[model samples]
Target: MQQSLKTAGVLAFQRSLYATDAQFYSVLPHQQEKPVWVIRHGIRGTQNVNKATEKEFSNIQITDTAKLDPTAEKMKVVFDIKFFDLANSLFACAKGKKDKEKDTVKKFRATYDAFLTRAKDSHGLKEVVLRYVRNCTNGRWLWRNLTLASTATITVVKNDETEHGLSFDAVALSRKGFTDYTADELALAELFVANLQGYATDRFRVTALLDFGMPGVQVYPSQLYTSNKPKGFARPLYAVGAEEPVRTVEDVMHFQATRKMGQAALRDDKVANAIRTIDTWYPDYESIQRPIAIEPQGVSLELQERFRIKKASAFEIIQKIDELDPDSPNGMFMIASLIRGGVYSGE
Candidate 1:
């Protein structure tokens, strides 16, 4: 309990909410099934001031007294690990002029024709393939309104009951809104909503401490993205173009057609091949889960019984399930069933 809340300075009220060890481990995904939980446990710097004066605060500083000397003790914890949600922190890959400066994860090097491929076939494929992936990484926005219920507001980092510490991470403002804003112009909830809509962060692994009312309720993330994002989470795009296939891949080949604009009923197979390239979520901000009945877990289970065959790997079955149930509002059930089935798959 003492070690649970380690951040030096947290809010007074937040310092009182502590969870036990048992509660924190409940969410940890199995090692084989675990997704990447990039944990960053360091105090970051931010500027705050008096409400009336709007001046820099002398006492408000980050931990690490070596940096602030006498005032370091006055610094407060910003993000709470034990009580915060990690799902929302997974940012998309950015592809912007700024990002292009570094030739590394620079940008999606799709041919112009490939850009047109997306522009023609998928409704908002252009935005998804281009701008979304281009600037997936660096945007700080959330979806929230001030009038939302306190119940909707989340205390991301609460104070530690057994230790002298506070959390500086973040809280899940219920499912609709956020209690705080990392940016002055945006709330955490608003930031998340904007980000989700703007980019496709559909695949994610959440590592969090769901200290809802218990101690140490750990919820390891099997899938990075959660099953609870509302409809229209994908941001809307405003562009001028028609969607269809290029009958003649002759003039505009894969790389050539990506940016050219045209509309027709027959989609070119070249576009299909181009899609194969974009299928993987990596290298861009594309949604991994499709909206078709891919996996068919129920059918698979029945088949296992009838054929008397050992069940396939839970991951395999889940992928198949995702294929079978693409209609699953981002395939929520498919993901859950996979997590459960794999966790107990008699490894």
Candidate 2:
């Protein structure tokens, strides 16, 4: 794992009219000085909810881990319920086990209880957070990055289809899910690799937009909408592929925590701490978070690329965008799209 507390920090980027990069920067320190290679949680794109009864929550069994597409790169991976249920089962044991110690049981229950309360009562919490994502507004958009500038887009994304190909293979996850998105607003029907009938599968997630620190170039208008927005631009990106299948309650819990903590490790040391907490609280964590396979950013022809224009000097890109998409009645939007998608190959 080339990533570190410092290196992963640099690559962690978030965009929103509501959230600042600094807040994320503060959460995850940028000691490595390289763009962090991260993918958000891609939940199962289904409206159906997996309402587990109390009985199901209490019983959890081990399952197989999801594999990665060996031949694919830049492919969006999805998670399964085997992992989620594994997490929930462990926690249930920690908090509900009659054989556990009082203090240990209390602490575990407290954590789970706190999480449940927030999931069910985030509206009240938002009153205290002022401008937080409060509810799982756009759960699909979670973990997606925006194109702040057009520096490496064309360069990295357009080089070859091989780098973007999707391969289906089993991978080991340490402490996270397919993407860094997790919320209850929508019940994502994911697959359970360990299930008797499923293999490697994820869900479809929506795309998002982002900004680069290019000078004078405005990535978009002052006001933005998801429909007319660029892909990977949304803070909490949506869209996912088909889910594997749900076999148990443990799958849901592990999937949920993994999705929440994918980028979380890079977000802050605290997130790592949270992982430890859950690990201790839940012992049967091996099933959901198998051996993780995240790659670290490196110095390559792609890294050589730089933003042709900077946020401070954004005149060039912006001027070109306006020229092409004149904001006029008949002007087309492809010009801006070209600029937005154009990769800054300049070193």
Candidate 3:
């Protein structure tokens, strides 16, 4: 799922769909055998926006030849966790007397007590991986393997009956690292960094919240780049000689081949090996997700299609995605993917 969504179109498609805890968790590979709670999902930002923005520029090595530092990425990202009482939600939706609500609460209390007792016998958690979708289209854009070293300020939100949830805000400084980006992705990164010269950002994108226990969330990242350009990014000599320049994948591939020949001539094995490993993801943007037999559970796909094409207002689409569906799969994802991938009909 992480590598699946890398295209801008796929991301736009993901922006259209919505899902519930049950539907989302059910789709997980290990859910049927061992179900884990999904706590929270959201975004965070660097405390010092200026420093973070500056680091982004330095990471890309876009400065003059004498000023370029190929490994200058360092920043911070903050996280705000919001928790809710699942038992209370279920009890509230239950149709019956007030006593039934009390009974449900008591049963949940007993179950939690037993669970804690069992959990105590297990070993402590060493690291926690907060999984999240950075952008729906570019599934590979993620902060998955994060190793945190920071303290959090926690606030509890309680209700008349029980302790509802807690909010935890933690700030962790970004680590220095190398990230591989495709040529197109690098172009986008260049565009964003160039645009950042005049812009300031205090916060990052927090598209949706996830409750994969402890309320895990995802946030946008900054200042990550690979040391070398992707394999096929070298422009061709013929294109360089031509009056009108063209930057095509074929040209890049040919340039790389020609350069590899030169490297072989000089016996520069290290540079040639690095060049051979140049990775790219241009084909991903053109991929299409085949329509699945998703059972609709929220707003009808027909109405969603209208909203997607601007036949309906943003408010309407928002309301539709926000609708609760505890039983069936929220077809918003299926419909959005199909439409954006050019595989679905409005009807």
Candidate 4:
């Protein structure tokens, strides 16, 4: 009789799809210039709803606001992504209980190897890469910024080679599904698959550009949390700038800056989350009709629900991954989760 597989006590995977923090730039209708800081100002508000008394209604508050440069006609967001070898990206630590350490380790390796072999044989990696490319071309990474743009164009340049790049109509692509693709989108997907599968000499640098046509529209950046927010401020935004003192309300909205460029930016993690929003395999996906970010538990914070309940989570499936069909949705999700990267130790 064959021995049943046991889970590894220390299993970890590194992120295969690495992205850099996206920087913002102000642009004219058809011109490129240095990055500029989004405008920061104050807004006055009055308490109206649920006011306790007449005096409460008169209570006014001041809050900080950030917007794009009023003088510019368009806003440009630029970021880069690097693809890593996903098949051999496991990072295992010490094995399980001493008595079964050797057996557990052996089983773990065999199971993982089988999983990768099946995935590669079935071309599962290509499907995942194509979905990632769909998200990139659709401007889903823009988050709130996507809603503001009347028209948007996304350009994907490999290794900064602008002459050999692909451009897509960001606004035209549907975010609700990933079933349709244009010829250019497929070409981009092929490039990604080639780089990820080690067909390229070196790791490819995928730089993405989002050009929005709205003039002076407000752009959103990753917001920072403060346990004790300054007076008259709603929230703080993530910024890269020189060390300075926070003296006023305007100072709370620190914009990302370099010696020559000042720009609003999104954190790399946020960009990564957007790029991996390809979890349509979740249980609720049929009803939701949209994909959520690939999470270990199939978590969708926006919906405040965990779609993968009970034995459906990546943690549960990974233990018996070798038993799963690599072409199935669940198997594909597990592979994507490994690429997404996280600790999945049984201990």
* Best-performing candidate as measured by TM-score: 4
User: How would the candidate models be sorted by lDDT, starting from the highest?
Assistant: 4, 1, 2, 3
Q: Candidates' TM-scores?
A: 0.17, 0.17, 0.17, 0.87
Full-model lDDT, candidate 1: 0.23
The most accurate candidate by lDDT is 4
For model 1, the run of ten residues with the poorest summed lDDT: 8-17
Clashing pairs in 4: none
Name the runs in model 1 displaced over 4 angstroms. Answer: 1-77, 80-194, 197-314, 326-330, 333-347
RMSD of 2: 28.5
lDDT (Cα, tens digit) per residue for candidate 2, span 1-347: 22111111011111101111111111112221111222333333223337855444332222112211222112221111111111122211232323334464444334433433332232322221111111112211122222232221111111133354222111111123223323321122212112111232222221122223332221211111246644423343211233334346766646542222111111222111121111111112254342111011111132252222232122222223212222321111111121112222111
Candidate 3 runs further than 4 Å off: 1-14, 17-75, 78-145, 152-326, 330-347
Cα deviation in Å at residue 267, candidate 4?
Answer: 1.3
Name the TM-score of candidate 3.
Answer: 0.17
Tens digits of per-residue lDDT, candidate 3, 1-347, equal 11111111111111111111110111123222111121111223334445565444322211100100122111121122121211121112122232323443344335433432332222210000011110211211113212221232222221221243323332221111113323433332332222122232212121112222222222122212345755423221110111323347766655421111110000122111111111111112124221211222222232342212231322222223223121112222222222122211111
lDDT of 4: 0.73
For model 4, how does the per-residue alpha-carbon lDDT over 141-225 read when each residue is reduced to its tens digit? 8788778777788888887777987888888898988777888888887877765666653333433344445456666888776
**Worst 10 contiguous positions by lDDT, candidate 3:** 125-134
